[model samples]
Target chain A: DAGITQSPRHKVTETGTPVTLRCHQTENHRYMYWYRQDPGHGLRLIHYSYGVKDTDKGEVSDGYSVSRSKTEDFLLTLESATSSQTSVYFCAISESTGSYEQYFGPGTRLTVT
Target chain B: AQSVTQLDSQVPVFEEAPVELRCNYSSSVSVYLFWYVQYPNQGLQLLLKYLSGSTLVKGINGFEAEFNKSQTSFHLRKPSVHISDTAEYFCAVSEKAGGSYIPTFGRGTSLIVHP
Candidate 1:
Protein backbone atom coordinates (compact mmCIF):
# COMPACT_ATOMS: atom_id res chain seq x y z
CA ASP A 1 0.00 0.00 0.00
CA ALA A 2 2.76 2.38 1.04
CA GLY A 3 0.83 5.64 0.84
CA ILE A 4 -0.34 5.02 -2.71
CA THR A 5 -3.98 5.57 -3.61
CA GLN A 6 -5.79 4.81 -6.85
CA SER A 7 -8.94 6.68 -7.72
CA PRO A 8 -12.28 5.07 -8.56
CA ARG A 9 -11.79 1.78 -6.77
CA HIS A 10 -14.38 0.12 -8.96
CA LYS A 11 -15.99 1.22 -12.19
CA VAL A 12 -18.17 -0.25 -14.89
CA THR A 13 -18.16 1.43 -18.27
CA GLU A 14 -19.46 0.60 -21.70
CA THR A 15 -17.34 0.01 -24.73
CA GLY A 16 -16.11 3.04 -26.74
CA THR A 17 -16.03 5.23 -23.65
CA PRO A 18 -13.03 7.08 -22.33
CA VAL A 19 -11.68 6.23 -18.88
CA THR A 20 -8.97 7.66 -16.76
CA LEU A 21 -7.34 6.26 -13.61
CA ARG A 22 -5.20 8.20 -11.25
CA CYS A 23 -2.39 7.05 -8.99
CA HIS A 24 -1.15 9.34 -6.25
CA GLN A 25 1.74 8.66 -3.94
CA THR A 26 2.72 10.51 -0.78
CA GLU A 27 6.14 8.90 -0.54
CA ASN A 28 7.66 11.06 -3.28
CA HIS A 29 9.12 8.04 -4.99
CA ARG A 30 10.86 8.72 -8.25
CA TYR A 31 9.56 5.73 -10.17
CA MET A 32 5.90 5.03 -10.84
CA TYR A 33 4.36 2.18 -12.83
CA TRP A 34 0.99 1.15 -14.23
CA TYR A 35 0.05 -2.50 -14.56
CA ARG A 36 -2.92 -4.67 -15.41
CA GLN A 37 -3.69 -8.08 -13.93
CA ASP A 38 -5.58 -10.71 -15.86
CA PRO A 39 -6.38 -14.32 -15.10
CA GLY A 40 -3.48 -15.89 -16.97
CA HIS A 41 -1.18 -12.90 -17.06
CA GLY A 42 0.25 -12.19 -13.66
CA LEU A 43 0.86 -8.45 -14.03
CA ARG A 44 1.85 -6.72 -17.22
CA LEU A 45 3.34 -3.29 -17.06
CA ILE A 46 1.51 -0.77 -19.20
CA HIS A 47 3.81 2.16 -18.69
CA TYR A 48 6.30 3.71 -16.27
CA SER A 49 7.54 7.12 -15.35
CA TYR A 50 11.07 7.75 -14.20
CA GLY A 51 10.72 11.43 -13.44
CA VAL A 52 8.41 14.33 -13.94
CA LYS A 53 7.29 14.34 -17.57
CA ASP A 54 9.50 11.35 -18.38
CA THR A 55 7.66 8.22 -19.35
CA ASP A 56 8.31 4.96 -21.13
CA LYS A 57 6.10 2.33 -22.67
CA GLY A 58 6.12 -1.21 -21.37
CA GLU A 59 5.33 -4.53 -22.99
CA VAL A 60 1.57 -3.96 -23.00
CA SER A 61 1.38 -0.27 -23.79
CA ASP A 62 -0.92 -0.56 -26.73
CA GLY A 63 -4.40 1.01 -26.31
CA TYR A 64 -3.16 2.89 -23.27
CA SER A 65 -1.39 6.12 -22.52
CA VAL A 66 0.21 7.63 -19.41
CA SER A 67 1.22 11.02 -18.14
CA ARG A 68 3.26 12.09 -15.13
CA SER A 69 3.10 15.84 -14.90
CA LYS A 70 4.27 15.91 -11.30
CA THR A 71 6.28 13.75 -8.96
CA GLU A 72 3.33 12.49 -6.98
CA ASP A 73 0.68 11.79 -9.59
CA PHE A 74 0.64 9.42 -12.53
CA LEU A 75 -2.35 9.01 -14.75
CA LEU A 76 -3.40 6.21 -17.11
CA THR A 77 -5.89 6.90 -19.85
CA LEU A 78 -7.77 4.67 -22.25
CA GLU A 79 -8.96 6.57 -25.26
CA SER A 80 -11.66 4.05 -26.03
CA ALA A 81 -12.45 1.27 -23.64
CA THR A 82 -12.80 -2.25 -24.87
CA SER A 83 -13.83 -5.53 -23.31
CA SER A 84 -10.30 -6.77 -23.62
CA GLN A 85 -9.16 -3.92 -21.33
CA THR A 86 -11.29 -5.11 -18.47
CA SER A 87 -8.98 -6.08 -15.67
CA VAL A 88 -7.62 -5.16 -12.27
CA TYR A 89 -5.26 -2.23 -12.54
CA PHE A 90 -2.48 -1.65 -10.03
CA CYS A 91 -0.07 1.17 -9.38
CA ALA A 92 3.40 0.75 -7.92
CA ILE A 93 6.14 3.07 -6.74
CA SER A 94 9.83 2.52 -6.14
CA GLU A 95 12.56 4.57 -4.55
CA SER A 96 15.09 3.40 -7.08
CA THR A 97 15.06 1.75 -10.43
CA GLY A 98 17.32 -1.20 -9.67
CA SER A 99 17.03 -4.15 -7.33
CA TYR A 100 14.46 -2.43 -5.17
CA GLU A 101 11.07 -3.51 -3.93
CA GLN A 102 8.16 -1.66 -5.52
CA TYR A 103 5.24 -0.77 -3.28
CA PHE A 104 1.81 -1.38 -4.76
CA GLY A 105 -1.44 0.47 -4.24
CA PRO A 106 -4.87 -1.02 -3.71
CA GLY A 107 -6.03 -2.01 -7.18
CA THR A 108 -8.86 -0.49 -9.21
CA ARG A 109 -11.12 -3.05 -10.79
CA LEU A 110 -12.56 -1.83 -14.08
CA THR A 111 -15.14 -3.77 -16.03
CA VAL A 112 -15.86 -2.92 -19.63
CA THR A 113 -19.29 -3.91 -20.87
CA ALA B 1 15.43 -10.24 -20.38
CA GLN B 2 14.53 -12.18 -17.23
CA SER B 3 11.44 -14.33 -16.83
CA VAL B 4 9.89 -16.25 -13.95
CA THR B 5 7.89 -19.44 -13.83
CA GLN B 6 5.62 -20.54 -11.02
CA LEU B 7 5.26 -24.30 -11.39
CA ASP B 8 1.95 -24.63 -9.55
CA SER B 9 -1.34 -22.94 -10.28
CA GLN B 10 -2.90 -23.86 -6.96
CA VAL B 11 -1.90 -25.76 -3.84
CA PRO B 12 -4.20 -26.86 -1.06
CA VAL B 13 -2.97 -27.54 2.43
CA PHE B 14 -4.52 -28.02 5.85
CA GLU B 15 -4.07 -25.54 8.63
CA GLU B 16 -0.85 -25.98 10.62
CA ALA B 17 0.61 -28.11 7.83
CA PRO B 18 3.85 -27.39 6.05
CA VAL B 19 3.76 -25.87 2.60
CA GLU B 20 6.09 -24.93 -0.16
CA LEU B 21 5.47 -22.73 -3.23
CA ARG B 22 7.79 -23.30 -6.10
CA CYS B 23 9.35 -20.53 -8.27
CA ASN B 24 11.91 -20.75 -11.03
CA TYR B 25 13.46 -18.21 -13.35
CA SER B 26 15.45 -17.94 -16.55
CA SER B 27 18.13 -15.27 -16.67
CA SER B 28 21.20 -14.78 -18.68
CA VAL B 29 23.10 -13.11 -15.83
CA SER B 30 22.95 -12.38 -12.14
CA VAL B 31 19.45 -11.80 -10.84
CA TYR B 32 17.42 -10.71 -7.87
CA LEU B 33 14.50 -12.79 -6.64
CA PHE B 34 11.40 -11.66 -4.76
CA TRP B 35 8.14 -13.06 -3.36
CA TYR B 36 5.01 -11.05 -2.89
CA VAL B 37 1.66 -12.03 -1.41
CA GLN B 38 -1.77 -10.67 -2.28
CA TYR B 39 -4.89 -11.12 -0.24
CA PRO B 40 -8.42 -10.71 -1.54
CA ASN B 41 -8.95 -7.20 -2.90
CA GLN B 42 -5.61 -5.97 -1.61
CA GLY B 43 -2.28 -4.82 -2.96
CA LEU B 44 0.78 -7.03 -2.94
CA GLN B 45 3.06 -7.18 0.10
CA LEU B 46 6.67 -8.11 -0.03
CA LEU B 47 7.45 -11.44 1.59
CA LEU B 48 11.19 -11.60 1.04
CA LYS B 49 13.98 -10.86 -1.38
CA TYR B 50 17.43 -12.20 -2.28
CA LEU B 51 19.77 -9.54 -3.54
CA SER B 52 23.04 -11.12 -2.61
CA GLY B 53 25.04 -12.75 0.19
CA SER B 54 22.82 -15.38 1.78
CA THR B 55 21.23 -18.20 -0.13
CA LEU B 56 18.88 -18.95 2.78
CA VAL B 57 16.69 -15.94 3.39
CA LYS B 58 14.01 -15.74 6.06
CA GLY B 59 11.00 -13.49 5.69
CA ILE B 60 7.93 -12.39 7.60
CA ASN B 61 5.30 -14.77 8.99
CA GLY B 62 7.62 -17.71 9.51
CA PHE B 63 8.36 -17.95 5.80
CA GLU B 64 11.69 -18.70 4.22
CA ALA B 65 13.20 -19.38 0.83
CA GLU B 66 16.42 -20.82 -0.48
CA PHE B 67 18.18 -19.31 -3.43
CA ASN B 68 19.60 -22.02 -5.66
CA LYS B 69 21.74 -20.47 -8.33
CA SER B 70 22.51 -23.71 -10.12
CA GLN B 71 18.89 -24.75 -10.18
CA THR B 72 17.72 -21.20 -10.89
CA SER B 73 15.07 -21.46 -8.25
CA PHE B 74 13.75 -19.59 -5.22
CA HIS B 75 11.06 -21.57 -3.47
CA LEU B 76 9.02 -20.33 -0.50
CA ARG B 77 8.41 -22.53 2.53
CA LYS B 78 6.73 -22.31 5.88
CA PRO B 79 6.81 -24.85 8.71
CA SER B 80 3.10 -24.40 9.41
CA VAL B 81 0.45 -22.38 7.65
CA HIS B 82 -2.69 -20.71 8.86
CA ILE B 83 -6.03 -20.16 7.25
CA SER B 84 -5.09 -16.52 6.93
CA ASP B 85 -2.21 -17.59 4.74
CA THR B 86 -4.56 -18.45 1.94
CA ALA B 87 -3.73 -16.01 -0.82
CA GLU B 88 -2.02 -15.57 -4.17
CA TYR B 89 1.75 -15.54 -4.30
CA PHE B 90 3.80 -14.13 -7.15
CA CYS B 91 7.42 -14.79 -8.00
CA ALA B 92 9.46 -12.09 -9.72
CA VAL B 93 12.89 -12.03 -11.32
CA SER B 94 14.86 -8.86 -12.08
CA GLU B 95 18.16 -8.13 -13.70
CA LYS B 96 19.94 -4.86 -14.33
CA ALA B 97 19.23 -3.40 -17.72
CA GLY B 98 19.94 0.17 -18.78
CA GLY B 99 20.22 1.33 -15.16
CA SER B 100 16.86 -0.20 -14.38
CA TYR B 101 15.61 -3.45 -12.97
CA ILE B 102 12.01 -3.78 -13.94
CA PRO B 103 10.91 -7.20 -12.77
CA THR B 104 8.95 -9.74 -14.76
CA PHE B 105 6.38 -11.67 -12.77
CA GLY B 106 5.16 -15.24 -13.13
CA ARG B 107 1.57 -16.30 -13.11
CA GLY B 108 0.67 -16.42 -9.43
CA THR B 109 0.11 -19.58 -7.41
CA SER B 110 -2.90 -19.56 -5.16
CA LEU B 111 -2.37 -21.21 -1.79
CA ILE B 112 -5.61 -22.46 -0.33
CA VAL B 113 -5.22 -23.23 3.35
CA HIS B 114 -8.07 -25.42 4.40
CA PRO B 115 -9.24 -25.95 7.92
Candidate 2:
Protein backbone atom coordinates (compact mmCIF):
# COMPACT_ATOMS: atom_id res chain seq x y z
CA ASP A 1 0.00 0.00 0.00
CA ALA A 2 1.12 3.60 -0.57
CA GLY A 3 2.47 5.13 2.60
CA ILE A 4 0.40 8.17 3.55
CA THR A 5 -0.66 8.97 7.11
CA GLN A 6 -2.67 11.82 8.61
CA SER A 7 -2.28 12.67 12.27
CA PRO A 8 -5.14 13.11 14.77
CA ARG A 9 -7.75 10.90 13.17
CA HIS A 10 -10.44 12.86 15.04
CA LYS A 11 -10.44 16.19 16.86
CA VAL A 12 -12.97 18.41 18.59
CA THR A 13 -12.02 22.00 19.28
CA GLU A 14 -13.66 25.31 20.04
CA THR A 15 -14.01 28.15 17.63
CA GLY A 16 -11.12 30.65 17.53
CA THR A 17 -8.64 28.02 18.59
CA PRO A 18 -5.65 27.14 16.47
CA VAL A 19 -5.26 23.63 15.10
CA THR A 20 -2.78 21.88 12.91
CA LEU A 21 -3.09 18.69 10.88
CA ARG A 22 -0.06 16.75 9.80
CA CYS A 23 0.36 14.58 6.70
CA HIS A 24 3.40 12.35 6.44
CA GLN A 25 4.29 10.33 3.41
CA THR A 26 7.00 7.75 3.15
CA GLU A 27 6.96 7.56 -0.63
CA ASN A 28 8.82 10.90 -0.95
CA HIS A 29 6.47 12.24 -3.60
CA ARG A 30 7.03 15.82 -4.74
CA TYR A 31 3.47 17.03 -4.60
CA MET A 32 1.15 17.13 -1.55
CA TYR A 33 -2.38 18.46 -1.28
CA TRP A 34 -4.86 19.31 1.45
CA TYR A 35 -8.56 18.82 0.83
CA ARG A 36 -11.70 19.22 2.87
CA GLN A 37 -14.65 16.89 2.29
CA ASP A 38 -18.22 17.99 2.91
CA PRO A 39 -21.68 16.61 2.22
CA GLY A 40 -22.50 18.17 -1.17
CA HIS A 41 -19.27 19.93 -2.04
CA GLY A 42 -17.20 16.74 -2.36
CA LEU A 43 -13.52 17.39 -1.78
CA ARG A 44 -12.25 20.94 -2.20
CA LEU A 45 -8.57 21.72 -2.30
CA ILE A 46 -7.52 24.16 0.40
CA HIS A 47 -3.80 24.26 -0.31
CA TYR A 48 -1.04 22.30 -1.97
CA SER A 49 2.73 22.07 -2.10
CA TYR A 50 4.65 21.25 -5.24
CA GLY A 51 7.99 20.99 -3.46
CA VAL A 52 9.68 21.83 -0.20
CA LYS A 53 9.01 25.52 0.56
CA ASP A 54 6.92 25.85 -2.60
CA THR A 55 3.17 26.19 -2.02
CA ASP A 56 0.02 27.63 -3.51
CA LYS A 57 -3.60 28.26 -2.61
CA GLY A 58 -6.53 26.31 -3.99
CA GLU A 59 -10.25 27.01 -4.44
CA VAL A 60 -10.97 27.15 -0.70
CA SER A 61 -7.78 28.34 0.96
CA ASP A 62 -9.27 30.91 3.29
CA GLY A 63 -8.29 30.65 6.94
CA TYR A 64 -5.83 27.89 6.16
CA SER A 65 -2.07 27.81 5.68
CA VAL A 66 0.25 24.99 4.73
CA SER A 67 3.98 24.33 5.00
CA ARG A 68 6.27 21.73 3.53
CA SER A 69 9.59 21.94 5.29
CA LYS A 70 10.57 18.44 4.26
CA THR A 71 9.83 16.25 1.29
CA GLU A 72 7.83 13.71 3.31
CA ASP A 73 5.82 16.09 5.50
CA PHE A 74 3.11 18.60 4.72
CA LEU A 75 1.27 20.46 7.44
CA LEU A 76 -2.03 22.33 7.31
CA THR A 77 -2.81 24.84 10.04
CA LEU A 78 -5.97 26.73 10.81
CA GLU A 79 -4.85 30.06 12.15
CA SER A 80 -8.22 30.63 13.74
CA ALA A 81 -10.59 27.72 13.62
CA THR A 82 -14.19 28.28 12.66
CA SER A 83 -17.27 26.08 12.70
CA SER A 84 -17.44 26.25 8.92
CA GLN A 85 -14.02 24.64 8.76
CA THR A 86 -15.37 21.51 10.39
CA SER A 87 -15.02 18.71 7.86
CA VAL A 88 -13.02 15.63 7.03
CA TYR A 89 -9.53 16.66 5.96
CA PHE A 90 -7.70 14.44 3.55
CA CYS A 91 -4.06 14.48 2.53
CA ALA A 92 -3.17 13.39 -0.96
CA ILE A 93 0.08 12.93 -2.85
CA SER A 94 1.05 12.62 -6.48
CA GLU A 95 4.29 12.22 -8.35
CA SER A 96 5.78 14.94 -10.56
CA THR A 97 4.70 13.03 -13.64
CA GLY A 98 1.96 15.67 -14.24
CA SER A 99 -0.70 12.97 -14.19
CA TYR A 100 -3.79 13.60 -12.10
CA GLU A 101 -3.95 10.37 -10.15
CA GLN A 102 -3.54 10.93 -6.37
CA TYR A 103 -3.23 8.69 -3.32
CA PHE A 104 -5.25 9.80 -0.29
CA GLY A 105 -4.77 9.33 3.39
CA PRO A 106 -7.40 7.78 5.66
CA GLY A 107 -8.52 11.33 6.62
CA THR A 108 -8.82 13.46 9.76
CA ARG A 109 -12.25 14.34 11.04
CA LEU A 110 -12.39 17.77 12.70
CA THR A 111 -15.29 19.25 14.62
CA VAL A 112 -15.28 22.89 15.73
CA THR A 113 -17.65 23.89 18.45
CA ALA B 1 -10.05 26.83 -14.21
CA GLN B 2 -11.54 23.38 -14.77
CA SER B 3 -14.80 22.05 -13.41
CA VAL B 4 -16.38 18.59 -13.21
CA THR B 5 -20.07 17.87 -13.05
CA GLN B 6 -21.74 14.68 -11.94
CA LEU B 7 -25.19 14.86 -13.52
CA ASP B 8 -26.86 12.48 -11.08
CA SER B 9 -26.44 13.24 -7.43
CA GLN B 10 -27.75 9.89 -6.29
CA VAL B 11 -28.68 6.64 -7.99
CA PRO B 12 -30.32 3.66 -6.33
CA VAL B 13 -30.17 0.22 -7.93
CA PHE B 14 -30.90 -3.33 -6.93
CA GLU B 15 -28.11 -5.83 -6.45
CA GLU B 16 -26.78 -7.44 -9.63
CA ALA B 17 -28.24 -4.65 -11.75
CA PRO B 18 -26.35 -2.50 -14.18
CA VAL B 19 -25.47 1.05 -13.24
CA GLU B 20 -24.11 4.28 -14.72
CA LEU B 21 -22.92 7.50 -13.07
CA ARG B 22 -22.75 10.40 -15.48
CA CYS B 23 -19.99 13.03 -15.42
CA ASN B 24 -19.21 16.08 -17.53
CA TYR B 25 -16.51 18.73 -17.46
CA SER B 26 -15.64 22.24 -18.66
CA SER B 27 -12.07 23.21 -19.33
CA SER B 28 -10.23 25.48 -21.64
CA VAL B 29 -7.34 23.03 -21.98
CA SER B 30 -7.33 19.31 -22.50
CA VAL B 31 -7.74 17.27 -19.32
CA TYR B 32 -7.10 13.94 -17.65
CA LEU B 33 -10.22 12.52 -15.99
CA PHE B 34 -10.61 10.31 -12.95
CA TRP B 35 -13.27 8.60 -10.86
CA TYR B 36 -12.89 7.94 -7.15
CA VAL B 37 -15.03 5.88 -4.77
CA GLN B 38 -15.38 6.59 -1.06
CA TYR B 39 -16.79 3.99 1.25
CA PRO B 40 -18.55 4.93 4.47
CA ASN B 41 -16.18 6.55 6.95
CA GLN B 42 -13.24 5.98 4.64
CA GLY B 43 -11.17 8.12 2.34
CA LEU B 44 -11.65 8.28 -1.38
CA GLN B 45 -9.89 5.66 -3.52
CA LEU B 46 -9.10 5.84 -7.21
CA LEU B 47 -11.52 3.72 -9.21
CA LEU B 48 -10.17 4.58 -12.64
CA LYS B 49 -8.39 7.28 -14.60
CA TYR B 50 -8.09 8.34 -18.25
CA LEU B 51 -4.73 9.85 -19.06
CA SER B 52 -4.22 9.20 -22.74
CA GLY B 53 -4.29 6.64 -25.54
CA SER B 54 -7.37 4.51 -24.75
CA THR B 55 -10.83 5.97 -24.42
CA LEU B 56 -12.18 3.14 -22.33
CA VAL B 57 -10.48 2.49 -19.01
CA LYS B 58 -11.17 -0.42 -16.68
CA GLY B 59 -10.44 -0.34 -13.00
CA ILE B 60 -10.64 -2.51 -9.90
CA ASN B 61 -13.99 -3.73 -8.54
CA GLY B 62 -15.31 -4.37 -12.04
CA PHE B 63 -15.88 -0.71 -12.83
CA GLU B 64 -15.09 1.02 -16.13
CA ALA B 65 -15.33 4.47 -17.69
CA GLU B 66 -15.19 5.86 -21.20
CA PHE B 67 -13.67 9.20 -22.01
CA ASN B 68 -15.62 11.06 -24.68
CA LYS B 69 -13.46 13.99 -25.67
CA SER B 70 -16.03 15.50 -28.03
CA GLN B 71 -18.66 15.65 -25.30
CA THR B 72 -16.19 16.33 -22.48
CA SER B 73 -17.60 13.47 -20.45
CA PHE B 74 -16.32 10.45 -18.57
CA HIS B 75 -19.06 8.24 -17.24
CA LEU B 76 -18.57 5.26 -14.98
CA ARG B 77 -20.38 1.98 -15.51
CA LYS B 78 -20.70 -1.43 -13.96
CA PRO B 79 -22.67 -4.28 -15.51
CA SER B 80 -23.47 -6.15 -12.30
CA VAL B 81 -23.22 -4.31 -9.03
CA HIS B 82 -23.07 -5.86 -5.58
CA ILE B 83 -24.38 -4.54 -2.28
CA SER B 84 -20.86 -3.53 -1.39
CA ASP B 85 -20.78 -1.25 -4.40
CA THR B 86 -22.79 1.31 -2.46
CA ALA B 87 -20.55 4.34 -2.03
CA GLU B 88 -20.00 7.93 -3.05
CA TYR B 89 -18.38 8.43 -6.44
CA PHE B 90 -16.59 11.60 -7.48
CA CYS B 91 -15.43 12.71 -10.91
CA ALA B 92 -12.27 14.80 -11.09
CA VAL B 93 -10.41 16.69 -13.77
CA SER B 94 -6.90 18.10 -14.07
CA GLU B 95 -5.31 20.13 -16.80
CA LYS B 96 -3.72 17.83 -19.35
CA ALA B 97 -1.86 20.67 -21.03
CA GLY B 98 -0.34 22.64 -18.12
CA GLY B 99 -0.40 24.07 -14.58
CA SER B 100 -0.37 22.48 -11.12
CA TYR B 101 -1.41 18.86 -10.77
CA ILE B 102 -4.29 19.60 -8.41
CA PRO B 103 -7.60 18.11 -9.47
CA THR B 104 -10.99 19.74 -9.61
CA PHE B 105 -13.71 17.47 -8.25
CA GLY B 106 -17.43 17.34 -8.84
CA ARG B 107 -20.19 17.37 -6.28
CA GLY B 108 -20.18 13.56 -6.33
CA THR B 109 -22.81 10.85 -6.92
CA SER B 110 -23.98 8.49 -4.25
CA LEU B 111 -24.63 4.93 -5.41
CA ILE B 112 -27.02 2.81 -3.36
CA VAL B 113 -27.09 -0.89 -4.10
CA HIS B 114 -29.87 -2.61 -2.26
CA PRO B 115 -30.28 -6.34 -2.00
Model 2 Cα lDDT, one tens digit per residue, B18-75:
9999999988677888899999988889999999999999999999999998899999
Error of 2 at A49 (Å): 0.3
lDDT of 2 at B20: 96
Please give the RMSD of candidate 2 to the true structure.
1.2
DockQ of predicted candidate 1: 0.81
Q: lDDT for each of the candidates? A: 0.93, 0.92
* Cα shift from native, residue B44, model 1 (Å): 0.4
Off by over 4 Å in 2: B98-100
Residue A64 of model 2: what lDDT?
99
Best by DockQ: 1
Error of 2 at B96 (Å): 1.5
lDDT of 2 by residue, A46-97 (tens): 9999999999999999999999999999999999999999999999998863
Tell me which residue pairs clash in candidate 2: none
The native-contact fractions of the candidates, in order shown, are 0.73, 0.66
